[model samples]
Target: MSEKNREGKRSARERLAVEREKRKAADKRRRALIVGASIVCVLALATVVGVLAANAGKSGKSSASGPATAPSGAVGKDGLAIPVGQDTAKSTLTVWEDFRCPACQAFETAYRPTIRQLADAGQLKVEYHLVTLIDANLRGSGSLRAANAAACAQDVGRFGDYHDVLYQNQPKETQDTFADNDKLIELAGEVDGLNTPTFEKCVKDGTHDSWVQKSNAAFQSGGFSGTPTVLLDGKNIYADQTITPAKLKQMVEAANKS
Candidate 1:
């Protein structure tokens, strides 16, 4: 071959090699940018999720700690339960409830009449322990606030009346209506003398929040499964689907005779 032809061919080969290397470098740079952008998007999404979680946790109030001051005449383990009916009654019914829990509300609506009759007759006594299960599970403070307000009512010897009133007017489970102090105070009008300044102060100040938190902690630690845990003389009668209001009354009457 001619020397000139050979030189031209070699130059052409060198140019092709250089063009290929440039394209490879450009492709590598584009891939690096794409990876960096993906990492940034992931990080931003994580931050957004973190912010939402924090906001949900901050609604209305926070989990309480330190010493717990219970309502007046509270009894039972750690003084967490609010007692109803005569202490001298023959049968003791223990109830664990959360105001924002739909099952608890249903239980109260179905059994309250019979329970009240039994209590008034001095045959049965009921002890109520309030917890904040809904607040923790649903991410709101209505359960905590309502429990605190109930404790406040207990302070003035009006707990039973106010407790019934609360259940009668309970809001939807998903609604955080009870979280507002003004709303709680407004509802006190349903119970005579429950709207007093002392009760109002107690409700607004969250006087029994720590106590409510303590009670909820106990409920969670005790391994019991859900709200409205009604126990009649140490038996979880609420879990027994066969039990009815009349049956409960009959059981209490039998216990009174025993």
Candidate 2:
């Protein structure tokens, strides 16, 4: 064989090795993401974190106790879910999450792009059920207040952008920074036209607090293990350690094909 051809073969092998290393590195990062705060479950969280007695007292309040004033465009049983994306989408992704949950923030940061992509493409629709797990698990109204603010966003048709903003600005789990209405309203300024007087009033007045409580109740009754309980067409995807943005895209594409 010519020396030049042998050199060419060596170059190709080296390129393949480089690609393999890149894939390995990407997988390692994904593994780290899975083991971080992303996979925390409520069952373990209950023992790991102590809820204040005052917070615990309100954990079981039913919608009948007050009006479950759902936001405009809310759907699902009892209007618990805040829907995003086209209604004509063939696949549905349901997510139960708390704005104050670190695990939820991690999950949102990692897969939000892919989820939004699929939802925007009309292949999938996302139904977000805002829960107050952290408020009940920890010792603050952060979860409740944040969830209420997100609901208020839905009322003004800004839920999608405001929801992402909340996760992006999530504070330390122990700090309870989200419990402040001013902070939540301040964060709303990041999203265009989301920080209006009405939005500010909704945040301060807790307009959707009862709706958030109802959603939390539904999440608890649904037997979900934790915050960011993501399901693709009724199958729990977050519990699957192998799940990645690429895998999620493939799954949604495959669903479209089927």
Q: What is the C-alpha lDDT of each candidate?
A: 0.77, 0.79
Each candidate's TM vs. the true structure? 0.76, 0.81
Flag regions of model 2 displaced more than 4 Å. 1-29, 39-65
Per-residue accuracy of model 2 over 1-258 as CA lDDT, tens digit each? 999999999999999999999999997886766534654536344532223223322222222245779999999999889999999888999998888787887888778899889998999999999887767665677788788888888888999999989888888888788777788888998999889998887777667777777777778778877877889999998788788888999999999999
Best by TM-score: 2
lDDT of 2 at 257: 92
lDDT of 2: 0.79
